[model samples]
Target: MYLRLENISKRFNSFVANHNISFSVDAGKIHGILGENGAGKTTLMNIISGLYQPDTGKIYLEDKPVKITSPKGAIKLGIGMVYQHFMLVPQLTVTENIIMGTENSWCLNLRQKQEEIAALSQAYGLKIDPAAQVENLPVGTQQRVEILKVLYRQAQLLILDEPTAVLTPTEVESLINILRQLAGAGKTIIFISHKLEEVINLCDTVTVLRRSKVVATTIAKEVTPQQLAELMVGREVVLQVNKSASVPGKVIVSVQNLSVANDRGIPAVSNVSFQLRAGEILGIAGVDGNGQRELADAIAGVRSIINGKIEFNRSCTRQKIGYIPEDRQKIGLVLQFSIAQNLILKAFKNLPFCHHFLLQPPAINNHAQVAMAEFDIRATGEDIKVSQLSGGNQQKVVLARELAGEPNLIIAMQPTRGLDVGATAAVHSRLLVERDRGAAILYISTELEEVMAMSDRIAVIYRGEFVAILDAEIATIEEIGLLMGRGTGGRKSAGTG
Candidate 1:
C-alpha cells in the first residue's frame, strides 16, 4: 500500500467523528472515499493531512509508521491536500502561490519558479497563466493552481475534498482526466465527493463511509452508481425525483433587463430576462463564478442590481424571500450562535422572542425545538451552537429555519453540494414539496445531475450569459455538457428545432 490508515479514531467533545476507520490506497491508483456530508470524510482527510491529530490510530506511508504532527510534516512526507475551498492568497500570483511554503536558497529565483510552474501546468494540461494574480483567475483555473501547488511540492499522495463541487461538467471532466493522468504517473490519489457518477467513472477502488465509520471498500468497476449510493447511505435510495409534470402558474417573479457588475466592475449578468412562475422549480446551471451569485443576490434583495426590474407575486410580496446561500459558513448561519438563535434570524424582527428590545430565550428555544422536530434537524439540543452540528445537519437547521417562515419564494444555491445520499434525497423531496405547494424556487447548482433531476426547466449559464433553456425531461448529460462548454446547444437542440 502507498498509504494506510488503521483504526483511526477522532472525537470532538462527546461525539466520535471517526470511529476506528481503516482504509488503504495503492500507489499509482485513484482511491475514492465516498460518503455524505458530515460522514467523517473531511475529518479523515484532515487527520491524514495533519490538520487534526487522530485520537487513536496508526498511519503508514510505504508501510512505515509515521507521525504527521503538522502540515509541514505532511508535506515532507509527500502528502498534500487540496481543500474544498482553495487556500491560495488571492493577491499573489499563481507562481508565487505555488511556491508559498517552499524554502529555497538565499538567492530566490523568481524566473526559475515561474518556469517550473509553467512546466508543471503544461504537464498536467492545466492552462494557467503563472503571472496572473489568483484573484483574477476564474474558479476552474484557480483550482488548477491549487493542484499545481500540491504537485510542485513533490507530493506523491494527493487528498482532494469535494473538488468538483464548484466546477462545471466540463471542468469536472478535465479534473478527472488530470487525476487519471496523475495516477498513471505513479501518484496516489484519495478523492472525496458526493457525486456518485464521478466516483463510478474515475476511481479504481472505493470506500464507503457513514457516521464516521467505513461501511465497505470495493473495486469501483464492481459497483454501480445506485449501489455506491446505497452503500454510502446504508439504505436503498430513490436516486431520481418522482415528480409529475409541473403545472407552472402565472409568473410569480419576473426579472427584466437585469444587469450586474462583478467585483472588477465588469458586467457579470447582462440583460438577463427570465420568469419564474408559482408551483415550478427553475434551475440555473452554470460554471462557478459565472454570475450565479450576483443573480441570486439580486433576486433575494441582498445586493443592489446595476439595472433590473423584479416583479413579485402578491403572495410572494407578503412573505419574505428565503435564501440558502452557496457558502454556508459565510452567509447561511452564524457559527457562534446557538441553533435556537439562528432559527429566528430572519423572523426576529417581530416576534414574542423579542420583548422590550431584547431576545427572549424561552420563546426562541421553544420555536427551535418545534422547528428541529419538523425539519428533522439531528442536533443535541436547541442550546447547542450551530457550529457543533455536522455540515448536513447545519444545512438542515438552515432549511428548517427558512421553511418555517413559509416563504413564497426560495433561492437555493448549491443546496446539495456536499450532502450525502440520504440528506440530498431529503432536501430534494422538501424542495419538490415546496414547489408543489406554490412556492417559486430558483435552484442554482453546478452539478448537472442535480439540475436535471430536480428542476422543472434547466437554464445553462456560461461566460456570464444565459445560453440555453431546456426541458429537464428531454435533456441529456451530453447535451448539457456541450452547452456548458461551447454555449451552443448540441444535437438535442437541433432535433428539437
Candidate 2:
C-alpha cells in the first residue's frame, strides 16, 4: 500500500467528524472518496494534509508509521492537497505562485525558475505560460497551475477535493487526462467529488463514507452510479428527476437584445434574448463565471441592464418575482439575523411580517414557524441565527423566503451549489413543485448534469451568449457541450425557433 490508515478517528467536542476510518491506496493508483456534505470526508482529508491531528489514528506511509503535524510537515512527507477553491494569488504570475515558498525569494533567479517550472509542466502534460498572471488564466488552466504547484514541491501523494466542480466539460476531460499522466508517472491520488460519474470513470478504487463512517470500499469498475449514490446517502436516491411534460403557460417575462456589465464595468452578457413562460424551466448552462451571474442579476432586478428590454407579464410585476441569488450566504440571507427575520426579508414591510415600521414579533414568529415546518428546515428554534444552520438548512431558509408568496417568476442560480444529496433532492422537488404551480423559472448552474435533469428547455451559454437553445428532451450532452466549446451558435437551432 502506498498510504494506509489504521482506525483513524477525529472529534470536535461532541461531534464525530471521522470514526475509525481505515483505507489504503495502491501506489500510483487513483483512489476516490465519496460522501455527502459534513460526512467527514473533508475531516479525513484535513488530517492527511496535516491541517488537523487525528485524536486516535495511525497513518502509514510506505509501510512506516508517520505523524503529520502541519501542512509543511505533510509536504515534507511527500503529501500535498489541491483544494476545490484555488489558493493562488490573483496578481502573481503562474511561476511565482508555484514557487512562492519553495525557494528563497532573495536569492531566486526569475527566468531560470520559470524555465524549470515550464519544463516540469510540459513533462506532466500541463501546458501553461509561466509568466501569465493567475487571474488571466482560464479556470482549467488555473487548476493545472495548482497541480503543478503541488508536484513542484516533490509531492508523490496528491489529494484533490471536488476537482471538477467548476470546470467546463472540455476542461474536465483535460484534467482527467492530466491526472492519468501523473499517476502513470508514479503519483498516488485521492479523488474527492460529489459527482458519481466522474468518480466511477476516473478512480481505480472507490470508498464511500456516510454519517462520519466508512460504509464501503469497492472496485470502481464493479459499481454503478446508482450503487455509489446509495452507498453515499444510505438510501435509494432518485438521481434523475421525474416530471410530466411541462404545460408552459403564457410568457411571464420576455428579454430582447440584453446586454449587461460585470462588477468591473465590462460587458459580461451580450445581446442575449429569450422568453420564459409561466411553467417551464429555462436552464442556462455554462462553465463558472461565464456571464451566468450578470444575466441572472439583470433578470432579478438586482443589477443594471446596460441596454435591453425586459418586459414582465401584464399581470406580473417585478416585485412579484422570487430571486434566489447564487451566493446564499452573501446575497440571499443575512447571517446575523434570526430565522424569523430571514424568512420575512422580502415582505418585512407587509401586514403579517411587519406593521407601520414597528416590528411584529408575534406575526413574524408565527410565519417562521409555518415556513420552517413547511420547508423542513431543521434548526433548534426560529430565534437561532441563520449562520448556525448547515448548508442545506441555509438553502432551505433561502427557499422558504423566496417561495413565500406564489410568485409568477423565479430566478434560481445554482440553488444546490454546496448541498448534499438529500438536500439536492429537496431543492429539486420544491422547484419542480413551483414549476407545476405555473411559475416561470430561470435555472442557471455550472453543473451540466443538474441543468439537463432540471430544465424543460436548455440554453447553452458561451462567451456571454446563448449559443444553442434546444429542447431538453431531445438535446444530447455532446450537442450542448459542442456549443459551449465552440462559443457560437452557427447554424444551430435557437430559442423556441
| TM-scores for the candidates | 0.91, 0.95
> Mind giving the per-residue lDDT tens digits that candidate 2 earns over 1-497?
89999899999899889999999999999999998877889999999999999999899999999999999999999999999999999999999999988785677899998999999999999999999999988889999999999999999999999999898788899999999999999999999988888889999999999989999999998999989888888888888888778999999999999999999999999999899998999998888887999999998888999998988998788778888999999999999999999998888888976688888999999999999999999888999999878788999999998987789999999999977777888899999999999999999998888889999999988889888788888887777766776675434665552
Question: Over the stretch 192-306, how does candidate 1's per-residue lDDT look in tens digits?
Answer: 8887888889999999998899999999989998998888878899888888779888777888878887777788998777888888888888777789998898888877789
- All predictions: root-mean-square deviation over Cα? 2.9, 1.9
User: Candidate 1, clashing residue pairs?
Assistant: 36-420, 37-420
Which candidate number would show the highest lDDT if scored against the true structure?
A: 2
CA-RMSD of model 1:
2.9
lDDT of each: 0.86, 0.91
List residue ranges in candidate 2 displaced over 4 A.
Answer: 489-491
State residue 230's C-alpha deviation in candidate 2, in Å.
2.1
TM-score of 2: 0.95
